[model samples]
Target: MENEQIKTIFEKEGITSEIQCPKAFEISEKYGVSKMEIARYCNKNNIKIRACQLGCFK
Candidate 1:
């Protein structure tokens, strides 16, 4: 998906500065995107990932 589309979804979901790991996974599955892609987007956009189940983001 395009970055703008993801941004819209994020806005709709109220994901501004941060998002939980499970919530990210839900967005990934719901949008047919990879978790890594989401991570990259978050990183590029300065959005923090919190409560990572795998301790990857922390």
Candidate 2:
């Protein structure tokens, strides 16, 4: 998906600056994107990952 689309999804999901780990994985699966890609996008956009299941993010 495009960046705009992802942004829209984020907005719809109430993700402004932070997102839960499960939600991120859900988005990844729903959009057919990799978890690493989602992590990269979050990192690049200054969006923090919270409640990480695997302790990947803090």
lDDT of each: 0.85, 0.82
Error of 2 at 22 (Å): 0.8
> Which structure among the candidates has the greatest lDDT?
1
Candidate 1: global Cα-lDDT? 0.85
RMSD of 1: 1.7
- How well is each residue in 1-58 modelled by candidate 2, as lDDT tens digits? 5667778888888899999899998988887867777777788789999889977554
Q: Give one digit per residue, the lDDT tens place, for model 1 in 1-58.
A: 6788788889988999999999998988888867877888899899999889876553
- The clash numbers for all candidates, in the given order, read 0, 0
Return model 2's CA RMSD, one decimal: 2.0
Candidate 2 residues lying further than 4 Å off, grouped into runs, are 56-58
RMSD of each: 1.7, 2.0
Candidate 1, residue 57: the lDDT equals 53
TM-score of each: 0.84, 0.77
